[model samples]
Target: MFLNRKVELSLLENLHAEGKPKLILLYGKRRVGKTELLNEFARRHRALYLVARQEAYEGQLKKMSSEIAEFFDDDVLRHSPFQNYDALFIYLAQKETPVLFDEFPYLVEANRDLPSILQEYWDRYFSKKKTFLVLCGSSIAMMESLLGYKSPLYGRRTEQILLEPLKFREACEFFPQLEQEDKVLAYAVLGGTPAYLLEFDYGKPLLENIRDRILQKNTFLYQDTMFVLQQELTEPRVYYSIINSIAKGNTRLGEIMNDTGLEKSKITKYLSVLKDLHIIERRVPVTEKSPESSKKGIYLLKDNYFKFWFRFVFENAEYIEQGRQEKLIGDKISPVLNNFAGFAYEEIVLEYLKSSPGFPDYIFGRWWDKEEEIDVVGLDSSQNRIIFGEVKWKALTEKEARQTLNQLVEKSVEVKWGENLKSGEIQEGPEKKYMLVGKKVGGKKRLLGDGYLVLELDDLVEN
Candidate 1:
């Protein structure tokens, strides 16, 4: 079930080969495969992997001592557990092996001094030895804090990896048995998380899987959205309101404020926390000069699973709890699923185009004004070229493709790139490129012949 992460594996492998003491800090959101990657790396080398849990400080230490003793085949050490982490870590430092502490934040939770303890041991013993240390956690905030100037473990890590979820294409690889469109639909619901993707049964109909595995009360993912929020935040209700508002299409700040009735300052703080957790994102128009300072920023739930949950599951929780799964799907989900997937499909198309060999080095994003919005915008600064693209989740005929392309061309003119170029802000007047991406474009050959770049869903998936 392991997929992608080739680059991450290579980096770990290189670290192993360095033949020196190393401290590697790895952190990511839950279900992002941090433990899996660490276990896989452990299998390839002489390593002691200990997964900490929510337990007393003494209990965790005893458990870790047992594992470390067993890993090093020391009978005496196993019989007599180390009283403190310093002693255990010092013993580990004597051996040239990697010691991986997964879910490290749990240990920090049980013992506030663990980071300082590790810092002291790492500086006194491990740093002078050939020991490799990996402290992995699901708490993004806690792990980042270890690198802060005031933290005990500051400057101790030789490398750090904030692992992220798989991309759309990699996620699609999980459901090879399903049709391309069905794969996209499943991704729209399950997102790129390996754990979530594996829960789905590709042999069944997509909706059937959704009903049985996600919508049902007893299912694991039924309450996953709330569970994740509860684990990451103290006040889940406020975060829920904000996420729900964004999911229900209150993307703008004012709209979210109006919908949630939360103060602007409070919303800003919650949004910052959500952003740190990788649950939501603040996006600005592609052409904006200062994105951070832009007043036009809009909020979007970046995690597909969370978006699907809030939009479909959370919204229809009453129906689901009433055992009306079929009614919920037909009345609430099916009619609007395509529209939801359309937005995600646009993002996938943009990702595919970004990875294309023909695609120049460009700053890729969407452009929007009060009246007009462009789904895909790529500004190739080196070549002084701009690409404007329209993405459709549904199939389009030749005539339809031409009409869409015409609209995209018209919208490209409305973009302020020309004015910026003329004002000597950008060196060259940009050469505009138009593109159309969709499930299927019937007149793709003709469109390409007519100097428009056309990309079908098949092309994107295959590439």
Candidate 2:
């Protein structure tokens, strides 16, 4: 059932081919398939894999000793466990085999000095041997800290990978039987997490899958959002309030503070934590020079499932608990489903444009001001061009497409992006391009003939 991650497998294989002592770090959020990728690689090579659990240090050491003894066929070693982490690593260092320590943070939690012990062993023994050691974890912050300047393991890893979720198109591969539009809807709900995608039943209707698998009390995904928060944050309720506020249309910092009744400072800290977790992100206008410090930065949930949960599931928990799934879906979700999909469709189009042929090298983002907003904006400094686009979820006729195009053109002029870039290297006026992305464009041929980049659902899915 494994899919994608060809590049990751290739990287591991290449590292193994080197036949030298190497320290590799693999980390990401939970359910991102880090363990799956590691298992696949382990199966391909003569490697010993140990998954650390939340247990006493002695228990972990004994379990690992048993696994190692089994792996090496050394009954004597199994009968006599190593005295400490250092002795165990010393024995492993001479074996010249790949040893993967998955969920490494759990081991660290059990023994605070494990990192220092590994560092000492690595410098004295393992570093000189043809050993491939991998330290993997789901705790993003903890895993990243191992490479920070303050950590004992800093500057020790030969390679590191911060694995990300699958892209929209890659996720579509999970449900080949579903239509393109259904695939999009499924992606919007389940996101690109491989584990989540497997929970969906493509044979069933989309709403049925959502109700039975996602919204029902006994299902895995019913409280998944809360579970993720509880695992990562100390104050889950405050974080939930912040996420709920954003889901309820309070994106701005002030708005979130007002809605959540939390102090601005607390909001800032919680927002930073959420951003690090990849559950939320801060967005600024595409044209802004310094996005990090921009005053217009607004927060949004980056995970589609969280966005959907807060909007629909969290908001209507009572109705769902009352076994009113039918009314809830028909009344609350059906009315706003199209509108919600409209926002997700914008993101999908942006992803499409990133791999689209003929699109210049650019930084893609949204653009907005007090007066107007553009759904998609691409700033190609190399080509001295800016692409302005609008996305409509409904089918569009020729006249509607033309009007949308004209409106985009008019808004592009108002922004005067060229003027903003005048101080930079590109002194000339930037060429402007117009694009329309929607479910369907009735007169796509005519629109293409008229020099417009019109993309329909089919075009998006196919490309």
Candidate 3:
């Protein structure tokens, strides 16, 4: 199930190789595989890894103390347990073995002074030893706050990793037998989250898998989104309304207000929190100079599974409860599935370009100016190169591709990038590159022969 985290594993190994008392902070939203990554690394290096639970402070000490005692083979401590976290940390600091606390926030929750105690012990003891103390968490907000200026653990971290969901190619590893199109659709449903991706039975038909995994009540996959929201926010219901509004196609702030009936100021605050949690995002035209201040900014559920769940599963909950998933698929899910996959496909293309930059294109995102919109846009202003792309989820014949590119080229005129490069001697517009990506692009060779950028789903898979 551990697909592709060689980069992260390598990073951890390099830190260990440094042979210092390193403090590391590893975090991501729940179900994104923070604990799994730790487990894998711990297995290889024989690091002492402990998972904290939501319990009283004394109970927390007893559980972790037993694990530590068992790890160190100390019969005295095994029976008595450490009196408190301070004693436990002091004892552990005696050894140079790496110590990892998964769900570190749970420890902090049980004892607010835990971070300060960690700071004290790390400075007083662990610093002298090669004890690589790693703190990991699923709560994005709290984990991030550990490094903030006000926190006791600030400036103590020798390394930090914000573990994210798998990218398209890494996620593709989960479904080897499925076709590329089905793979894309599956990604759209489960997203890049490792835990969510594991829930899908790709061996079964895609729809059946979705029915059993997502629509079935009490299933882990079905309840995970709620779990994420509930874990991250104190007010999950209000955030749910805002996310639902965006999910229902109210991208504009005003539109969301109209749909949710929440005040603009309140929605803005919630949106900021969601954005911080990585559950939602605000986007503006890629060409905009100051995206933060851009009035044209629109809101979207950035997480694929969140987008799909709110738009489909949650909306059709009654039918799902009634176990009419077959009818639900026919009437609600299948017809719109292609369009839904199109967004994920576009994201894949953007990620591919960024990861394997074919050109010097630095800035990348979707672009929109009035009625003109490009699915993916890449800007390399230094070289005066601008790449405009259109992504379609369905197959396209050569003629269809040509027509789409032609329309894309026409739209490119409105997007102005290199205005400063304008001079009397150099009297041409920015260098434009046109790209078209789809599930199966027909006559791709012919299109490439004509000097147009063409990509197919299979072509991306090979990479």
**TM-score to true structure, per model:** 0.96, 0.95, 0.96
lDDT of 2 by residue, 53-132 (tens): 99999999999999999999999998999879987987887786799999999999999898999999999988888879
TM-score, cand. 2: 0.95
**Candidate 1, lDDT over the whole model:** 0.86
Task: Please list the residue runs of candidate 3 whose C-alpha ends up more than 4 Å from where it truly belongs after superposition.
Answer: 420-426
Taking the tens digit of each residue's C-alpha lDDT, what string does model 1 give over 1-463?
4677788989999988988889999999888889889988888886789999999989998998888888878999989998988777778767777889999999999999988989888898889887788999998888988989999988889999989888888887787777889878888888888888888888888889989999998888886767767888999998998999999999998999999999999998999999988888899988887889998899998888988989998888899879999999999998998898888898888778777787858778999888689999998867778888899999999999999888887777667664554223445457778889888999788789989988888887786
lDDT measured at residue 337 in model 1 versus the true structure, 0 to 100: 89
Clashes of 3: 0
| Model 3 worst lDDT window (10 residues) | 417-426
Regions of candidate 2 where Cα sits further than 4 Å from its true position: 416-428
lDDT of each: 0.86, 0.86, 0.85
